[model samples]
Target: MVAASAATCLVVTFVILTWALKDVPWRQIADGSLKPIVVLENANGTPLVRQGPYQGPYISYEQFPDTLINAVLSIEDRRFMDHIGVDPQGIVRALFRNIQAGSVVQGGSTITQQLIKLQYLDSDRTLKRKIQELVIAFWLEGKLGKEEILTRYLNSAYLGAGATGMSAAARIYFDKDVEDLNLPETALLAGLLRAPSQWNPIVNREGARQRTEVVLDAMVDNGKITHLQAGAAKSAFAKVNPTRPTPRSGSWFADWVAPQASEVSGSSPGSTTVRTTLVPRLQEIAEKTIADTLEKSGEAASVSQAALVAMTPEGAVVAMVGGRDYKASQFNRAVTAMRQPGSTFKLFVFYAALKAGLTLSDRVLDAPLDIKGWSPENSGGRYRGWVTLAEAFARSLNAASVALAQEVGLDNVIAAARELGIDAELTNTPSLALGTSEVNLLDLTAAYASVRLGKAPVEPWGIIDFKAADQPEAFRVGQQSPQPVDLSPYQSDLVDLLRLVVEKRTGRGADPGVFAAGKTGTSQNNRDAWFIGFTEPLVVGVWVGNDDDTPMKGVTGGAIPARIWRDFMRQALRNPGPDTMSDDSIAGKDNSPRSCNVSACSRAYRSFRPSDCTYQPYSGERRICER
Candidate 1:
């Protein structure tokens, strides 16, 4: 037994010595080298934003408040001052607690070890990396006293909201210096060190409050603060308001593109310039329209959040509004939130039926429908007994849509949706015909873009190209065009259906006083509202609802969402770019007679001569030219 114990001790000592002899990054630590800076710009070369690991002013040890110091030590390392460098007691306690909880609920790294990691080592969770961390922690302790070590830790630790140190965090969160933070504020900052982005006070107030309460409780248990003090601190924390230092303009676009820029630049040593697909003017228009609409009618309609996305028919994302206010919350609803698309998903069903040999002039029943114990009804509890496919679609008759899906198999419907780039999970149930599946705004908008371009799918892109400082050549995305499914056979009929919606149905609210095509959607109990449409050159999507999936009071896709789309498109088209159609093209000046095909008329109605053909309101078939 003695021989085995001595052998184990010798092996452990030799491993420790080997790790201690490894080269320390003293020069890099002293110089404070960080990750490369990424500068994002719009398509027009206008700078959107720049992000880097910036270090703030150095604060002395004496500048830190007692409450701040105690709060951090209590939660992060309870035995920070008592242990030499690595605390075996803290490690054993953390391991036991983690085992009991069946998860990693606690960390055993001391302040010294964390500083060593921040300054000298990568964050790999390997046994060798941990031993090296411990060795470096001991070496650092030997070189500096506790006060100096704590000061450096406070100066180098990364807090949330682009802050790199306690000094920067104080200024970023409270708009004050480090010495001015009170007990509750200090506790909030300390709590952020664990998960900065998840509990950012400016973006997630409830998360921040809950984490701060945990820190206060720990302070009380550690005997650093009295129970009364902890209670008072909790009360004060509930009222704390943090400042938003990040820029609001184009922040959603910038945040979405920054990580992609870093990846495209690879591990290059210097900065990189990323030219993105964002159009600043269009982005501004989208943001203002959402804010104005929500401010005007959000509370009255019980809608607190909205997201918008606009992209060209070729799939370049020109503008995006993730939420009403990017500063209040950085959650990119346009790119992240998955909500039911409602009747907007019917587009896929109708397209599938068209491919199944059904024409727009074909008649279908719109009465009550029941399939496999599931009954679907129309909006007003009324229906046309038998109507043309165009009228049924324009009216958004759920019964007709479901029947069509049944006639052409659910697999075909799912295939149509998948062909249009909707990758959301879908079920093969009757409710699937009514868009019971959830999809994000970005992918839904991209799907519509494909329809507008006579293509089955269009992959949306943000970053156009990026150039690192040291590299001579730029890395470009979509240098080779992707092959999309050909949707030309049913393109005209699909356009006619969407146009009928705007001209004679639920999507009337979205008309921009010009030629356009789109569909309106309302989920169950009005929980999600959506309006996705397109003009000649642009496709835009809008969604309005609450974050908790609560229903809005009487809000539907045809109401606020369509109006928001209208306001934005109106402002966006005012410049008279490629979005506008000339008068001559609409009138058709040629004197020669030509047959007016209904599909061609619907697809090119903006350029179709009204004098060349007669009008038949109810008939889906085209009329012969009288000229």
Candidate 2:
């Protein structure tokens, strides 16, 4: 009677708990909005040109040969369909073996549980995650029929060497598909899932073949396959090891995409598709451009690191190469590396000058100027005493820009950069006008793209569309596209002058034909070299130097880095290709000189004006009389 009463209470408690969480939907739990996707297309609808490192041509499951599936299953888990989520007998045996082994050599969790751990849970090894796994397992048992769970598990599991799903894994491991795998091929692929990075055939064929033999031994012991068959599969695998290394795909973009991905994923980590604005073609061209430049310049011996990124008029990241090898080095210099922008920052300095009523026609003293006694020298250590703004910028004259910065005020430059989506923790010291301030490659590129995008600055983003994996139809997509960061369009004249930078000024080195505008930068001591620019359309920035602070040999921003920019922009703007300046102070529409009321404000360009001066009609101000 006592036992019966206890059982009844237990049943009641179970019923209440189930009823409470009964309404919870599994679809939400499986949704993948947490992970980011890559942007593969540019704002102008160009595809990212893929460079190198492809394992094999991608093929859908149906396109895969079926024999591969039989060989893999024959070796991996023969009772895959016969068992439920967990095999009770298998668990008891594995637990005893673990106890004997004195460690977790064997996991009782089935493929479904492993999938749950890898996909939905963190990597922390603890009791709490196990409890959650049990709950989900029970829920899964009732929610998804056995076959559905298996399919999801198999498709979601990691195979090896950056291959995540079975489809990718099969092709990568065997150069075949689930349907095409022979017995030996199946055994080899199955062995890969046990320890992908370790047992990867491309990385270690001997180890992988050994692991396959172990799986075949298990199949034989379990009576799933004959002893002769197991031996045959082993022998076949030993004879048919992968002939070459499995190449990695999308490594460059993957490196740059990881951080944004981490932000989007929040807590979960798994195979995610990051939709980038990268044009694979453009990316290849950019990468090759830098490589070719380095090779010919005799600089490749000491230089091993470089990064590049290109954007379209609307500010989409069209192509990116964060490093030479993504797997070998996870450090992404393209998006996160905060090095000195050097003189490339001049673009903003000049823009701020124009915004503050200074113009290309303005004549400023470039000789012997000091900001708070911090003297700046020209690149060649010689200054032209009196030069027009156009001549100064044409030669990338440092003294002129520093003088301009002091004249217009440093705070104005900061404000102008902010308007262009440049949020790279600025330190706007006066020397910053000469690119002394450090900034990431992405920030620098996006800032210059502001001129191309007119008044609105668009932040670089990876994933544009996402949906929960569980829902076949339901999903979330980016609606209305990227929001515009407003800029004054009346600044078209400023845009036109900035474009001349590539054609007539210091950036003449960046001229890639009829389609571009750009700027070159070399940090103090030549520790960093950079060339950031935009075509009539695309924005590109390239950085080349040592990962260490060591100065590279005979390398300059205008030479190698600028060449890379030219090569990339030339290819990016193969389509064909700015205008006059205007005032942002007057809603960017201050083109109406007739309606002007300010006496000091002038539509004509001026140089070295006092702070109180404003544009005015010839008859309007005392400054006009001085002129």
Q: What lDDT is obtained when candidate 1 is compared to the true structure?
A: 0.80
lDDT values, one for every candidate? 0.80, 0.62
TM accuracy, model 2 = 0.63
TM-score of every candidate relative to the true structure: 0.60, 0.63
Provide the lDDT at 476 for model 2.
17
lDDT of 2 by residue, 1-627 (tens): 999999999998688657644544357555522232222322223222233322222233444344334444444445555666566766886799899999987656666677667667767676556656667766676676665565555556677666656655665555554566677776677677667788888878788878888877766676667889888877777567564322222456655554553333223323233334444456557667766766776355366678897766555555677866566776788876789878888877777787788767888878877557788888778988888887777687888888888888889988777777677767868788887777889878877777777754556654332222221221111212245655564356556655767777666777887766667788888788888777665677889877877887766787778777777766665643211111121122322122211112322433212122223444645442122
The segments of candidate 2 whose C-alpha lies over 4 angstroms from its true place after superposition are 1-145, 152-165, 174-252, 262-273, 298-304, 323-328, 473-491, 571-627
lDDT of 1 by residue, 1-627 (tens): 999999999998997767754666766554444455565666765455424343445566888999999999999998988898999999999999999999999989899998888867888887778777776677667777788888878877888788888877887787677898999999999999889999999999999999999999999999999999999988988679997444423677777776766555444443566667787778878998999999999999999999999888877788889998877898999998999999999999999989899999998888887676889998989978888889888999999888888889999999999989888999999899899999999999999998898985787777666655544455444222346788899999999999989888899999999999999999999999999999997899999999999999999899999999999999988974431222121112223233333233434343332222334545476544332
Question: How large is the C-alpha RMSD of every model relative to the true structure?
Answer: 18.1, 14.3
The Cα RMSD of model 1 versus the native structure comes to: 18.1
